[model samples]
Target chain A: MSFELMLFDNFLIEKQAVSEVLLCNKITEDYSLALSEEQALELVETRSDSLKNYGRIEFGSGIIEKVILTFADTPYISQYRYAEFLNELVEIFYYFKNETLDLISDDDLIGTMKKYFDGVCQGSLDQLKFRELERMAKNVRLGLDPDYNDLYDSEKLREAEDDDE
Target chain B: MNSVKKTTKIDVDKLSGEFYFQSLLQEAYVKGVLSPKESERVQLECLKLLADCTERFTRGKSSSVRVEIAQGIMASNLYTIGIHLKSLPDVEAALFQIENESIEKLYEYGLQVLKRKIKVASYFYNRVCKTKLKTPNQAYNITIDQGFKPFFDHYEINFHAHEIPSDIDYQLIHPVTDLAGVEFVIKYLENLYYENLFCSYFDADIIDEVMTGYDPSYQNLLDNICEQVFLNALGCQLLNAPLHPLDFSLADLDALDRQLKKYSQAELQRQLKTAAQELITNLLLTNPSLKKYLIASLPKITTTIYRGLTTHSLNKVFVPRNNPNIKPIRHYNMGIKMDDAAYREMVTEFLSCRFFEDKLAIIKEQIKTLADMEDLLIAAELKAAEAAMIFDLLEDIELAVLTKRHPLHPAIDAIDYSASEVQMQQNLNAYMRALPRDRLAKILGMTTTIEVV
Candidate 1:
């Protein structure tokens, strides 16, 4: 029997305007952070933002939480979405971390790629409920998983997530 | 001078009505609108635009000058457009109709007038005339300096030298005022559009209140400039015509003025955007350039190009009275007589000002950058080598060569004429006819108004 793979534990909502689509918030004030089940469904219907590569909404040194893009409903066993997302993240990573001026050996390039690749492995989101992300937070630069490379930590991404319960 | 000798009398009516200032508006200005080259091109365009626009002001088929007719035509044309614009469709279309009809109806015929040795003052441009006291080259420098000064000077006299360059035909054109009013009003319209756009998506009342709180001058400036452009294109000037007072201002402005100002800022801005739109809407409704400019992408590059050379970029503030963002017009003239110290002070201020310095620097940088690009383009001797050259070019800081030969390098040029007594009198006659008697009267009455106000 196979267990479902969870991409990341949390999908942090960045801005209010876009958050409405994911039922990120239910209350209709100037800002609402949590959406009711009905509101979330309504939001999902209204908005069509998918968390491809977790998106690079805000840029330049300033984001606290590293949001991840995971399946909103039931996580399926034996799927490769994490790989797809990682590929995009790696491209961004290669652009920014890139040290060698087209001269570094292939071995060194492979090592560099692997270093970031492993950092993106969150193991399983279910177990991260009470775990502190200090190690990853300190290690990863600009909201990117240590494995991913590229510009600016996200500023205000408005992507929503799976049920918190 | 060579240009003056070459200058032959021609009928304004015979000249095609389609192109205003065509003789002066060289190829550079016709396409890019306002660019770095415009410094010199403006001299040409203004001549072309004014000549085409005010053809009716000409009294004879071929006279040296007719100051009086030019004056009357400017006033009459101004009133017609300022009062009767809008229903005419667009500014360009209006300009077309007025360019043909109003000018044709008013002026019985046409004449390429000339003035010899008579004092020529360009009140419309900045206060940058260095009158005939020096050589052609030196006079050109002084006249170029006049482009930097505002036209609104208490003193309007600056003498450069006696001779003129061969490129320009007119004996001596007055210091054409910088036309900052045009730039200023365009900015006002843009602001109104931005605010109105924001409000439409946000809150209506808040926008209204904010607009209400704005300085009355903004509305006045907007109306006046639009009205002025319309009128001028119609071949007229609004020296004393009344403007409609709007809801924003308690002061009595003319009725027509009020309606134009009150029109939705964004819609109007979106509509009258193209310089061609401006020309076509006012002069030719079907001009293709009209649609091109109006529908062009955001961050209007033309506005960016000739934006008020003054004003801080990036760091902006919101203010009503002393708003530095406002386009500074050519308004300062020291007086007719300036001693050594005053002239030096004027030059110093112009150089030190942020706008002029910034513009000068930017233009210089653009020139240098273009040279670097040219080097890379030529390095195409080998594909891989060229790519390497491009990368190398980007890295090399000093390699930037100033391609000194920009289209507008010799920015200002003039041609002075040896006036015969006959030509001199003809010029004197035009001045006597169109002399700004109203301005003189107002100036005389100003001392009393100062105390009363």
Candidate 2:
């Protein structure tokens, strides 16, 4: 077999393992929406298509696991949106990885994404992806956040203001 | 020196209109040319004329431009005063009559006029001073002032015996009495064909085409002494030699000329032939199996000829602060002419050799080992060559790993090990690949790798 076919087979196996774990997580245990073999393959295909759209390729690295772990504890995350959100988050992670000059660590970027998604974005994936993360990327490019330490600080403060109101 | 007091604060704009009229009146009274009352009346009339000119020049202009125009008017008035006193019997007395404040105001304006005249004189002198003249009996005939005497003395000590040919016009050359003068001479001679010929040949036009053109094998030898002079000057700058123009003594040029004379065209050709034969022998020894390919490719080997110095060399040659023109020598590439098909065939043969595959394997192994290391800082500390090998390997690995192709056994094993490890490997690979090739080469050449911790 060609090396790419072998690698793709390995990738499919790894994706199956990750999908089984994600579907059986404690937060989604109450929901009876388990992904079938075909559904899992579709999820993998969606991931490959999203990655290609961003001009990126994965080497079976678990960016999906990290995104799941980051958003797993959110109160609004439901079984229906879980798989699709993970797919879009994977694409956004790789796209912004290049956009932020690759200076922000993966953990820091995940933390920034969770802060925007849970706080200012208030569980709206569209707002987090299009509005907050885009602005943060621009700030990073213009050297406003050299270390990215304050990437989500203002959003956190605004969340506090909204809670008080 | 008495034209302006060192401490005077002269504002160019403030020295216009009323201020200029007051200064003129003060000068008239001090010189006893007019009584105090008469001077005051004359100053009032002058102020009217000054105001009229200012209004005319500043029309439709902004405030800042108006101020600039007013300053120009004041300057014109000063120029008129200068012309009036140019041939005055007591010019020094009239100049001394101006108050310290007025003198300070006019200092820059007056100095500019003097500078322009000096520039004209220098231009003419540089052009006409090349006529042949009898050499001075004494080395110290140029009476440089006491402050400049030490620099001139050092020049004499270094280049006393080195003189240009007596047949060349002295008027064409600047007398190299100081460092700046030496630089001027070098700059002038750079464009002159005669000086270039002198650099290569002991006598001008000695090589005749009629005598040397009969033999098809004959090659002409050009003097490269001037290039050597530039190199040595660059070396001197790198060493931080205190004197300007990075002095090249006459004796050094003469010695270089003699060395060039020793290598005849025929002898140089013979040496080149011997060098080529030795190179082929060495190449065959290194790769015995590729003997046929080497033999075929040897005659067609075309190396790029670098025409000029690098940026670093140019920087050293013309230290920016001292030589602001900063004309970096132009660099160009020249290669041996070969048919495209033949060149492509040669390249294919060379790339397909077992030597390239062996090298690629070694580099790949080194990269995989470095990628496996837990601490990136330890990998960073590898020798420059090892680091360069790792860098190239990482680029190839990244391309393969990303595309899911060229699956090296070890790399595939590493991919199966853990995600974070793979991520770390990818990050390091990208970082190293992003670095400049020259930088990677330098790092690899070093004994120890750079410390990242």
Candidate 3:
């Protein structure tokens, strides 16, 4: 469909479709990209330190809790861990999308996004990060020059968009 | 082939400069036969042509004089825009600059009229000046500098004081946001109002800036902008079309042509009606709370403009699809068309059944008062509009409508003007633009009276 189809995006019932596509693409599974299920679990353990490190850098700890609930259950991980990570990750995403994204630069957003992305790749986060490109494309379709560029890796974004779609 | 290339007695006369100009329109003439990078190619040619035209045409004129002349020509682009908008096929498109591709690229006027601003978040809402004007037959001065006054007896939105543009008339009105404004532009330009183009310079790169998105390669933005410009023109065309004001359906007036061109007339109209209807439904019928934003948007003067607008009488107050008493309401607002009494009576009978079966009088009275609000205010301010405003009563009228048509669940309604008063009152105009509906509401004079009888 033409890019103007973006306006109809308001009618979309779920953004999770993008996430499902990401998981199916096996993007997060790319161990070759320096991230692996083992590393994700370790990151989760370090993040959440359920046993110790309970009270330092609460935000970072939150990030840890965030990663745990998010990356919890794959063929490599368990569902219990998945729920924790999903719960924390979504709250943070809302915080970032609703709160900090605009005041901060894409550099900071990408930096933070990269941290979350580090926890889960080739799966949901990658697809979600890449979804912004479609929004830009939609803006182009709607006759708005979305004054944001120089913000992402275009080739990776294109590849990710193709994969997500 | 070699002779044709090298020695084709290139008869410059055969060109009338038009053909060479046309050839130059390609990458070869101005770029010295370089590869056609879209911007480079188009920019180099048009600019070089513009330069050549000015330099040669201003023969023996001082460079300063040439610059001055160029500036004047560039300034004329505004006139061009006014004319272009005049031809728009629909009102919405025209107001939004629908078909005027690359309009934003045109020099951003340092002096901007009031725009309707939305709040970005809980702490900030941008103030947007929403002005609605009906198209008129002849130019009328809309005295602007005399500005607006705070007349709020009811309602919570802030009323802004504006300085009317004195250039058009001692009256501050610039002519787009009022019925007379449309007429002002039309009558002023019966003959094209040619300005001295030999005086100013046009910013040649702004269109690219406006149309270029984060993905620089996105070519469709320009196309869409163009389509919008055209749609805006279509609005003008629709309003100006010879349909008797009584016969207009707004649908019969204009249609939008955008990326999808294959849709038939009915399909396109349905699509447009759907979009326009969203605004109408929200503004007139939808509960303000059930929706994301308030319909008590920019139009501190919308109803007044509606009354002034002779066309589209049905728009006086958009009765929801279910409102049975809407038929009598239209007659109540419009009464009979004095010029075409026969046709008007015929319309009343034919359309009345579709509108309502009961309580026509009260509904009619309500809509009539609603329609008269703007007219009464404007007429009152005709003598001294700037320092004094007649909006307090109208604002109350608006509040009455909102309160009566209260859409909020009785228990969980957000405070009215929470978005505007909290954010906009703080003067965070530039911020909160993107996320306009996110402002927090100020708890000033909210109805907390739970009268549990």
TM per candidate? 0.14, 0.27, 0.18
lDDT of 1 by residue, B1-453 (tens): 555332223332332222222311222233333254443333333233334443322222211122333333333332222223222443444334433443333222111111111122333222223121121233233433443233223221111111121121111211122211222222222322222222222232322222333333433222111222222221111112211211221222233233234434454344334332334443334535323423442233223212311232201111111223433232221123334464455435434546534533433343244333332233222233322323333321121111111111122312232223223223223332343676434433332222210
lDDT per model vs. reference? 0.28, 0.41, 0.29
**Alpha-carbon runs more than 4 Å astray in model 1:** A1-165, B1-252, B257-450
Restricted to chain B, the TM-score per model reads: 0.15, 0.21, 0.18
Clashes of each: 72, 13, 82
Sorted on TM-score, best first, the list reads: 2, 3, 1
Q: What tier of docking accuracy does candidate 1 attain?
A: incorrect
Candidate 1: residue A106 lDDT (0-100) = 26
| All-Cα superposition RMSD per candidate | 37.3, 38.7, 31.6
Judge candidate 2 against the unseen true structure and give its global Cα lDDT, from 0 to 1.
Answer: 0.41
What is the lDDT, from 0 to 100, of the residue B429 in candidate 1? 31
Better of 1 and 2 by lDDT: 2
True contacts kept of 3: 0.00
CAPRI-style grade of the A/B interface in model 3: incorrect
lDDT of 2 by residue, B235-316 (tens): 2332334322334333433443343335445453343344434543532334342233323322222110011121122222
